[model samples]
Target chain A: MRLLIEIEVRFGEFVLSVNESLTLDGVTALFGPSGSGKTTLLRCIAGLEPRAEGRIEADDQAWLDSKAGVSLPAHHRMAGMVFQQALLFPHLSVRKNLLYGWRRRGQRPGPDFSEVLDALRLAPLLEQRENELSGGEMQRVALGRVLLSAPRMLLLDEPLAAQDERRKAEILPYLKRTIREFQLPVVYVSHAVDEVMPMASRVLHMDSGRLQSSAAARVSGGTAFGAILLGATLQRQLDSRLAVFCVGNAEVIAFLDSDTPNAREVLLAVEPRDLVIATGKTDAPLNAGAMDCTVRSIGEDETSGNLVLELAAGSSSFRLEHSFARHSDTVLRVGQKIRVLLTQPARVASPIVQSGTGRDSA
Target chain B: MIRAVEVIELDSLWLTLRLASLSTAILMVLATPLAYWLATTKAGIKPIVEAVTALPLILPPTVLGFYLLILFSPSSAFGSLWVQVTGQTLSFSFTGILLASVVHSFPFAVQPMQTAFENNGRRPAEVAQSLGASPFDAFITVTVPMARRGFLTAAVLGFAHSVGEFGVILLVGGNIPGRTRVISIDIYTHVETLDYASAHFLSMLTLCFAMLVLSLVFIVNRRYPIRT
Candidate 1:
């Protein structure tokens, strides 16, 4: 499914204008700074912003059409939203809040009642009141409540922003698992790069209330210039400092400098500058992962005057940026074969289960 | 053991209770929508509507009574319409006093409810809608339950204010024993006739009742510790 949107809203001097058709394949991250209309865009999609005008079509259903004067009310939009604050029904118990939307689904098919509880681990907290749950637990329950509503699409506005590091660590895995299991088209709004890297299969960057660009997240994650190796399972630990991961079709050896022994699976993020381009295979050090790649295309960074090369490795593709002077002697073509080295140690993210640490840090 | 004069005094007290009960019931029904509108509307005339609702809070009861009396006179449009409907003028009647009490107690019924809605915010209602609840369903299921304390406070204050009304009732519904004579007016009658003994008894009773009502409010407020 895909979403076709052309919306414009004006709040005094500030105007938010967006025109894009997003392919709702996986998690699509709306990435931007705090005041850059990321949340506004998400709100517009959910039919929460009444003043927003323009056409929004999800598949063939028209959610909003200004010229036709058809603006579906929020309840009829069939878009479930999870806000930054859990905003659970304080008067209701955890079980009631979870069942609230499920009971209101009105003949629509939804997730099984018991399965949602199991997925979000909400069975234990069912009898508890809203105030009794912790931040992470509350957010999980909020997500579960929205999921039970059986919406066509999910709109999340910084669902984890209110949590501290430890709470975030506690909730991220459940979020990842829920999205994977539900397989619903999700528009995830967040300003943090670390968050988008781990969750987003595509990123739409926004700035100053205008959409900047939309980039595909090949098989794994990240935008045009960054790479996130998702679902990289641990092959084996060679020593205290060395480990191997099976990323896609290649066995990549990674350097582990921290205690991540309990990380059964990890997400590895590599920035644009960390990838090194070499015309011929170089004798790389033990700490880096080197692979054969074919240069798909090359372009210049307009702002920094650096050459950015789009490369394909096995079934995955990524971009590598380098200063123009560094590669002045070599001529590069669109389909030239080359070798790329992951020089820096990719930042290792939280494990699916953190075991016992980082839970009560706050 | 009961004297005839005490029986007459009891009748006035009974009249006061009936008036207070009816006024409180009507105000609650009217205030729900008015308070909700005041809390959520962004219209330019919101301040004007708010000021009108709160006029009774600041204006002296006698001034409000004077205007109400004029409006209820036989020559006025509303008074003439009332006369045509019920074959009597609005002034000097129980219905007239009831209307005056509702107007006098308007702020007491609305302010607490409006504050509650504002503190509860639009987020909860919007969240409810996103969860598949219609607007009215969200209001009844989520908004009302969340702001219950405000409703309780408004009811108690409105009831109390109507029970304590004196000047407005005196002007709009002229003192005619058993008809317009409420407890406050009855107490005034006792004092005017140099009947200090009867006046003291009724005054003490009202004082104790007021204290009990206020204490109930304070205790409930302490237990719940309202959401700021």
Candidate 2:
């Protein structure tokens, strides 16, 4: 689905004018500082702010058309939003809160009721009240509540921003799993780069009420130039400091400097600026994962004055950007074998695809 | 002493109850929408509307009564229209006193409700709307439940104020024996006739009823205190 939005609103000293057309599929993270119109943009999309004059179209549905004088109110917009707080009704029990939105779906087909309960791991907390649940638990229930409503596009406005580190760690994986399973266009606002890197396939960077940059976080097919997400598995967990992952059969010994996912299946993110490339395999340090790959393409970034090298290791291809002088090392070629060392472990992300129900394997 | 004037007391008591009940019910219905608008709308004329609604509170009862008397006289347009429609003059009638009481107790009904709506704010309604409730549905389901204390206070205050009304009712309805002789007017008549026994009894009754209404408001408010 695609969304075209152009809206302007003024509040005392600040005037917010944002105009952008976005492809609203694949989890897209909206990153910005506070008071940067991230929440306002979501509010406009949800029709919570009616006075905003703009045109918004989601797929074929025109949510707002100013010339035709069409502005749907919040109730008619059919967006299932999970707020930063108030994930569920405070006055209701967990069961009642779920049922409230579940019954409102009317005749639309959505994720099955049992599937949401199992997927969000909310069965144990079904009888509990919202206050009884922890922050992470409430966010999970919030996701379940939204799924029950069968939204066309999910809008989560900083869902995990209020939680502590442990709670955030507990809740983010469920969001990642939800995105993977539903594959709906999920637009969420977040401030942390670590959270954005693992989950969002696309990132829209905003500043001063405008989209500064937009890119595909994955390889080849998006707008911004963020870290590329790769699908790899934890092939071996030999010791505390070392874990081996088969990124297509070249056993990559990734240093586990911190907490790593216990699940054998994990996603690894390698940033282009973090990798070191040499024309030949060298005496690499103990803490870094070194790779032997044949270079596929080389180009210089006009803005950064860095040589952008695209290399292929086994079946996966990745890019690296490094500053270059006129004469530094041996000349690089298109098909030359080179060793790449990553001093920092590629951050371990949640498993890309998990069982869609009853996830006992956390 | 009580048995000697029991019949008059009963008649006056019944009339007062009927007038207060009718006035309170109609006032609540009419004031709810006005209070909601006043609480929520950012319209420029809100202060003007509030000033008009509050006029009855500060204006002397005699001044209000004098104007209402003129307004209900058959020589005036509204009085003549009422006479033409009902085949009776509006002044010196039961309906006249009822209308006068509604005007007198307008603020009592509206102020508390307006305060409740403003205190309740727009968040609950907005949340309900996102959960698939229309505007009116949200008002009834979320707004009303959260503002129940305000409703209770407004209703009790309106009912009690109408029950104790004397000056405005006397001016509009003229203290007819079985028609407009409410408890306060009956007490006034007893005092004028030097019948201290009946005056004391009816005065005590009004005091007790007022106490009951005030106590009910306080208890309800205490039971369900607004939590943030």
Candidate 3:
């Protein structure tokens, strides 16, 4: 499914103007800091903000077109939205709340109630009142309620922001299951980068109500270490022959691999200091994974007395920063070709396309 | 001491209950929409409309009584208009007394209902709208149910206020026996004829009835405190 939105909205002191189109076969993360217009854009897509200008079309259907003077209301748009708060009705039982939207629509074919209940794990809480449930249980029920509406698109606005770590860990797997099992396209809004990393296939970055950049990043599990580069395919199992991955354009082979079935796209952790740069291909005997790379850009790391180099290989790019040394080997400039070597290799499981969609096996 | 004179005062006591009950019922039906509009409308002239509704609260009873007396009299414009429309004068009639009571106690009925609607925050209504409910449907399903306590308060206050009215009733419907001789007027006639025992008996009954209605107001309001 394709979702297109080009809308400009002005509220008192804040002005938001966004024009972009996103393909939705997988989860797309609207990633940004607070007050970055992520929620506004989501609302506009749902037809909640009628005052916004511009057109929005999803799956080739015209949902909102300002020039044409056509705007569908929120309910008619049929996009299920879950807010930060669970917003369960206090007076209604879990079952009644789940069926609220279904009963209201009169007669429309939608997701089966039992299926949604089973997916969200809400069957046990069906008879309980909203106030009686814990935070995680309430959110699970809220998800069930939205799913029962059987919306064409799902909008989740910081669904995990209110939860504690324990609650988040408990709900994360269930959410992953929903995305994989249902195959529903989702526009997930979040301020936390870590929260979106594992769930999002594509990340749309925003700053001050403008699109800064959009990139297709390989999804990785929660880790404190910097970014990892995964290979396209896992070739073969080597006893000490670690899987190698290219950073930017410079390729490095690592001697680490696990026998896990899903490990195809392996990850290599590179500390900036471990990389050695030369003016030309090195004559010295090198480690298993090392390659000739060209310096594309250079910048200083103020915290650590090191110079960061952006190296290029064909169209790909990666970074290598080295600390100050008494004997500086070479002064690197943009567009300068250089060779780099890795002294030690840390191997990881190769990433595999576990499900129908591509998921990092790391 | 309980006396035969007190036993004879039951008729006026019964008449006061009937008048208060009827007037409260009429006001409830009429004031609900008016109160809802007052609570929700953002029109520029809303304050002006509110002031008009509150006229009876500030206006002296004697002043209101005089104006109502003139309007219902046969010689006035309204009296002539009523005669033309219904072929009867309005003065000293049962319907005329009811009209005077409704006007005098309108603000009491409207204030509680208006306050109730204002406290129900706009979020619930917005949620309802998002869920496919039309404006009318939202008001009926969400707004009305949420403000149930307010309606009860308005009804009880309106009934109590109507029963306590003296001057407007006296001027609009004079003390004609078996026709306009309500409880307050009965007490006045008994005193004028030097029948202190009968007057005292009716006075005590009116006081007790008023206290009872007031307690009912407190009880209902306490049980169902309006949810914000």
The top-ranked prediction according to TM-score is 1
| Local accuracy of candidate 1 as per-residue lDDT tens digits, A117-217 | 88989999999988789999999999999999998888989899899989988999999999999988888886455666556555566656877433222
Q: Which residue pairs clash in candidate 1?
A: none
Candidate 2 vs candidate 3: the TM-score winner is 2
Give the TM-scores of the predictions, in the order they appear: 0.77, 0.72, 0.64
Evaluated on CA atoms against the true complex, candidate 1 attains a DockQ of: 0.44
lDDT of 3 by residue, A1-362 (tens): 77777788888788888776667667876655457688888888877776689888987889898899998877677777887877776556899878766666656566788888888888889999766898899888877777776677678888988999899989877777777777788878765544565566654545457653232333322111122333433454345555545544555665553443444344444433345555444653455556566666776656665666666554434555566421376666788767766555534423333332334434
TM-score of chain A of each: 0.64, 0.62, 0.64
Candidate 1: where are CA atoms >4 Å away?
A: A216-362, B218-228
Which candidate number maximizes lDDT? 1
Off by over 4 Å in 3: A22-26, A53-71, A163-166, A169-183, A204-362, B1-109, B167-228
Q: Measured with DockQ on alpha carbons, how good is candidate 2?
A: 0.24
Cα lDDT tens digits for candidate 1, B77-125: 9889889999987899999999999999999999999999998999999
Say which prediction, candidate 2 or candidate 3, comes out ahead on lDDT. Answer: 2
TM-score of the second chain in each model?
0.94, 0.95, 0.87
Off by over 4 Å in 2: A87-93, A120-142, A164-183, A216-362, B1-4, B214-225
Task: Show the lowest summed lDDT stretch of 10 residues, model 1 chain A.
Answer: A353-362
* Native contact fraction per model: 0.77, 0.35, 0.15
